[model samples]
Target chain A: MVAINKEIVTLDPHLIGVDWGSTCLRVFLIGSYGEVLATRTSAQGSSSMNGSAWAYEQSLEQLAGDWLQEYPDIKVLACGMVGSKHGWLEVPYVACPSDVNAIAARVMSVKGVDQRRFDIVPGMAYRPANGVPDVMRGEETQIAGVLSLRPEASQRSCIILPGTHSKWVQIEQGKVTAFATHMTGELFAILRQHSVLGRLMPSQQNELDPIAFLRGVEDARQGMYLGFAHQLFAVRTLGLMEMMPPSSLADYLSGLLIGHEIQAGLGWRLAAGLEQAPLILVGDPSLCAHYAQALSHCGVLNASILSNTAPVGLWAIERATAGVHATKLAHKVNV
Target chain B: MVAINKEIVTLDPHLIGVDWGSTCLRVFLIGSYGEVLATRTSAQGSSSMNGSAWAYEQSLEQLAGDWLQEYPDIKVLACGMVGSKHGWLEVPYVACPSDVNAIAARVMSVKGVDQRRFDIVPGMAYRPANGVPDVMRGEETQIAGVLSLRPEASQRSCIILPGTHSKWVQIEQGKVTAFATHMTGELFAILRQHSVLGRLMPSQQNELDPIAFLRGVEDARQGMYLGFAHQLFAVRTLGLMEMMPPSSLADYLSGLLIGHEIQAGLGWRLAAGLEQAPLILVGDPSLCAHYAQALSHCGVLNASILSNTAPVGLWAIERATAGVHATKLAHKVNV
Candidate 1:
């Protein structure tokens, strides 16, 4: 293995990357080149595991212990929903672009807290143009870790992170200046499950026709004259089906919402010949792929799909405080 | 009662009434000397009860079942939501200024429906200036009923019927020349129930503050450039609680949406003092109170709030039909 960078104390390769969440805790034992070596997993979801320190802690300890049995002395990296209030050690929210070290500052050494010492990561916060305050617990780390990997994306880029809550974050040189979170996910859920529109759509989410999806993008770009619900009903009442296929409705809903988020985030004249601003998307491969396709319709062709930084964040945390002191030793020599 | 000329049926005294669907559907049971008579009642509602007959049919059945028990031979009429797909038998919609008899003729008789020999009134429909087709179902009958009660309202008047689906109807002379239904109710439901805004609001619908409600109006008036959802999240995110109590979020939501509707419906020109057109409101006293309050914000003072007209519609239908019968008889004589 290549010599370990003294500036960052990490094994030539690391032990495991831990992501403890409300539902599931995933562990990725990765190598130096970010290749996942062996995966040892355990079932210890936060929400399900009542705030008991013993059983839940033991579940994680067993996971790491099993990994150590294989390598005997590999380092571990962890981040994600595992650092929240209900997470393993209750790591707090960190301000954005503060670097991997500041995030690790919140990472406390829990003696007997677990089988070994592990650091927890913090999230990020944003204030939007409308002056509305918003925060993301795990996604911030991913964005930062992603930024850390590719410095080029740090300039004049908007990150469309789609999830249950789609967040459009404005980043300028490694700093998350502002962001807006659109309730696209919840809207989809309610529309598909609760609202009358649900009747017209499939019982399950599936492929949306491109034509219908584009119509939704046009509506979002138009920006005025209809409420989300009003616009939603119009799709049914105005006989959008007369022009477009019925199955396209779901795709249209997803496109309409995400396009609106993009439109709002990229606050310029949305009408007329479109602007060619590049969009950096951080989401599931399938969704971001669709979103990138949708963006291309509006002349946003240079859209880059960024890999998820959850594992990168876990790696960053592990490298910050890994076996045999990387950063500390590097700093001593530099001084 | 004095035996008046059959031609004088148009000048008959009528009842003041209310319908179930949060809007109008009223009739007046008045004596020959304009004295109040027995007022018949029925539950006013508009949800599409698919397994059952049209909503209005059920409404008519309920009223007829109750009233026939008392005045078996008394003439009855009604209007508003009951005139919709959910209302009394499906009345084929007529284009507006499109009057009383046309509505009656279009009314479908529900087979083995509500045990009554009454005609349910239909509203008006029209093609908009934008070339998109639009229509109203139940409110037009009441507007006609209102004009029948106070013919003076017919002289270039604007009737504001506020509810879930608020309609601002224009009456030139005795005709409802045009009208548009704002999906205010649908917007309200989505805003209050499904949006990110729901979190900012209190679980109890009643706990609203008025000052914030007024700001909701101003926000709409000044053009906060907000998509209706922002008005909600603003309350919690901006700490609008500092400026106005959170209770007003409901009213603000109501006024902001309605005001936005007015902004859009009145065709961008509504802001340059919409008071140039006199507004006559036809709705329940409670909702009318809100309409009056909102209209004052738009600076249209002393707007008239007429009594709901489902009952008057019931009576007006009888009067109009009676006149038609008289005309048939007189034409027969003339021929």
Candidate 2:
């Protein structure tokens, strides 16, 4: 077995990568080459854990205690909301345009129950030239994983992490130059669950009706001049008028929000002069599919999808940090 | 006093105007001159009453049974969601571009427990040339009231009724020609109460922080290219970075939504070539103030505010219907 360092004794089952988000915790026991050897997921997200140190420790122990027991010195790399102000430990954000090395260097360390250190990757913050600052906690890791999987994407790409807060990130030469956060998913959830539009729709999510969804997307694309809030009213009107059934209304609403998001995202890319950059979607397969459909509808036909890249990203960061430390140690030994 | 009908009615306690909506029931005792004599409001909105005919009858009786008893033949005119599909009696929507005459002609009658007939005014539906159909429940009556109060508005005007579903109506020659619904208020409410952005703001809405609000408006004004959902994330980032406090985030969010709404409404107005039409704000005074401020900021200088015009609107509809009925009777007699 290849030695990682004095601390991480083996390369196989090389690292423990944790993607701790607001509502879910995903753990990956990764091999040296960034392959996920085994995986575990739980609903014990950071938010549910209430940022309690003991709870976080207990959760980690419960989820991957055997890995810690079997490989006593293997390093752990965690990302996402687990690094936020209300996370296990408030790992500060690394500002953009940041590379894997910049992110790796800024990771904060916390001790597990056995006193072994775990590295929590810092999130990235992007300040627009004149608007309010934008921030992403877990998406940076996903983007990193995309870069690791498709190295060319690192040179020039626009990676979209489509979820609650969808991020359209700009990458240049292996660094995230800038990114914007779109609240499309969150808006859809709230609108479908709480607004007047929700009343006309079935309480539960219906199956995605492709025709209805595309209708919504087309409406959004053509009705951009109508304003978003106005366009949203169609959700209710369509249901009331029986133009769209209750089952399809939700899909329509989803399409409308996603459509608007793609329109805006494309505009953002065009404005950044990254129009020629390769476009990539990184998220849940189904969500990516919806985004892919929307992007294709928006005349973007070349966008590709990558699923859950957190493990590889975590691996990349861990290795980068280890190399930086190894170089520092060698320099000291020579001196 | 003047005899009004064969059933024997005086003109002083002219009509009972009810503004029964989704969340609240507002009743106005109006005089012959369309002036409100007395008003009563209750939390028994149509939704809460659950389309229970008994509950709606009881609500109206409890609030204005005295007036009904005093003038046994007095006419009653009700508007808003009270006539919705889920209301006391489902009145079909009067298609646009409809005036008071068309709306009054379609008024449906319902019998009270005492058997006195009451009129429920139909809402309006506007199907755009190439988009989903738009519907408004009670706002049609309010438009009628605006026309009565300011006759010149009938020639050409834009009346903005700002609320849960803010309606930007176009009036041409005393008729609601076309209108657009912007869900600004509802959107703000849901986003402030449910979205991730809501978590950064104070649970209890803080006092309007004007500076923070204006800042958000300006950002939305200049950052239209960034897409609405993307710009929404600033509500969270601005709070996280300590650039803006939690208390101000809600206001900032409000400003952003309102600003976007105004931008869209203005664009709709411009597209319809009604730029020269007088702009009027008709809704809650406080909400109108906000809209007025937003409108002024967007370079529309003279938008005026008209508060709760439902009473006059009901009066106008009742008079129009009475005139129509009288005409029908006289025509029958002549024949």
Candidate 3:
């Protein structure tokens, strides 16, 4: 009934930042300085809740009810799939090149049970001139977090958020110019669990083999001409021939898919003449390390990994929205 | 108990040809003229068997017991996963560039029930001069069937067998010189069934949309620079953006995967300087037709479709093995 690992509670919670994604609901109680004073997480993700309006309110209340009671007027901001069409509310995507101000301007505010107010962040959509459009939900806030921490990055940088759908984003002057989504993690998970490649791997995962992993990265780099489907077949042949142990096959496959992602991502970067831009990865530390290793194999060495950027990102959006409101109030008084 | 759609019974069955793959068992009663007189099939593919000698024997008997009983001394030749490591017996792969003679020479012979001899054709392995090795079990026999039907194709040809693991094989002078395997079909199936992309598609599959299919193919060709994982995201975005209906998304995805296969297959062929080689597709007519259409979209106009090559291929291997035996007998008499 209570939040797990209920950390030191903030007596004066300034903001409540919720990173509600597809499968996990995480709420961060933020202090005035944008520090996470306490955190609560539950298995109740947006996808798990019933589509009914009360279900979303009930799920959020169950996780952060005590904090809400103590700080009745605390500004609450949530991001990610919670705003998706299938989520608690459908927040329209803000078209890129978007910035903190642009995103904050479009936040969808909703009234909860007993008149509690919550703001949901709008995601970003990118329509390339010549190709299909790409979209990202919670990652926009993560990118905002990166910009919050490293304002210099906003001048010109490429930030990669690796997960189910890894985003390779390009930022210029605090605005997201364009970004590409690579379904690396999702593909790897599905292939490992459902494809024939999974049959060759040990059911109990083994420690990652550096040699096999690097070999897969190298293979993906050199085998780009053959495309991915062909290169992936190596996972089977390598195991069938006993070239790699069963334990190492999964790691090798991981490296292979990530390598393909990096290869394509770098190509996307280079094609746009953004190769010299500062490259940073924002997400889980270990996953970023793998991406860094694969990127280094492909001659990219400037990628830095940043973790837990969502809360700060939420803070940044709140400040931007408040600033816009102040300017509007000032203009109204002058009129 | 009788075979489904039991056609004209062969009065004198020359050979019992079996194509046992991962999920199905098929038997062809070949007449003296190489025509399939009566055919039998079952769901007991090599993968479903118990891996015991009797299980395979029983599976075949269950399908063609009447034919086996009437033709006691009839030569039985089986191909595909039946000779794989997990099949009835592990048949070593014959190295490429292998002809019918080389493949038949490595045919693993096992004694079935009642002391009947069964010959399982060896699969082919291609260890490319560079990169990882590739292997195929039953497709080799299908290639041999192609050779039998069109002798000139042996001089130089590129044969594509489109299926779960689509193969782009090169043949020279009746031998399988080299090949590449694309996991297009398998990847499509898993992605459709398990991945986030599938979430946007209708649970009940709709008819193929040619326009959407071609759009995917064209996008794949133009978007090769972004790699497959990136191109694949379009399937989700198109649906989410409501640019394409749920019904057409699956077809678009199919086109995207097949297009990547074609692009990569063409690159592999061009890399080997076999661009001008005869391009022939052998497999299920509908599937092969899809590949053919995708290939034509890529500016490849000469691809011809051939169906039911496995039975003929089994017959070709049988004849080649018989000829080799006659040659050895003559040589012994001469000595």
DockQ winner = 3
Q: What ranges in model 3 sit over 4 Å off?
A: A1-6, A324-335, B1-6, B324-335
Considering only N, C-alpha and C atoms within 3 Å, which residue pairs clash in candidate 2?
Answer: B154-B173
Could you tell which candidate, 1 or 2, scores higher by TM-score?
2
TM-score for candidate 2 (chain B): 0.92
The per-residue C-alpha lDDT of model 2 at residue A15 equals 87
Steric clash count of candidate 1? 33
**Candidate 2: where are CA atoms >4 Å away?**
A1-11, A324-335, B1-11, B324-335
Q: Chain A TM-score for each candidate, in the given order?
A: 0.78, 0.92, 0.94
Model 2, B1-335: lDDT tens digits are 11122333234677888999999998877776676767778898999888898999998888877878887888888999999999999999999889999999999999877777879999999987777899999999999888877777889999999998999999888789899999999999898888888888767875888888777778888887678888888888888899888999988988898888888888889988899989999988988998888778778899888887888788888989987321111111100
Q: Write the per-residue lDDT of candidate 1 for residues A70-148, one digit (tens) a residue.
A: 5656655566655555555666556554555556566654434436555566665554344445556666667655565
- Taking chain A of candidate 3, what TM-score results? 0.94
lDDT order of candidates, top first: 3, 2, 1
For model 1 the local lDDT of residue A320 reads 57
Q: What is the lDDT of residue B53 in candidate 3?
A: 85
DockQ of 2: 0.77
The order by descending TM-score is 3, 2, 1
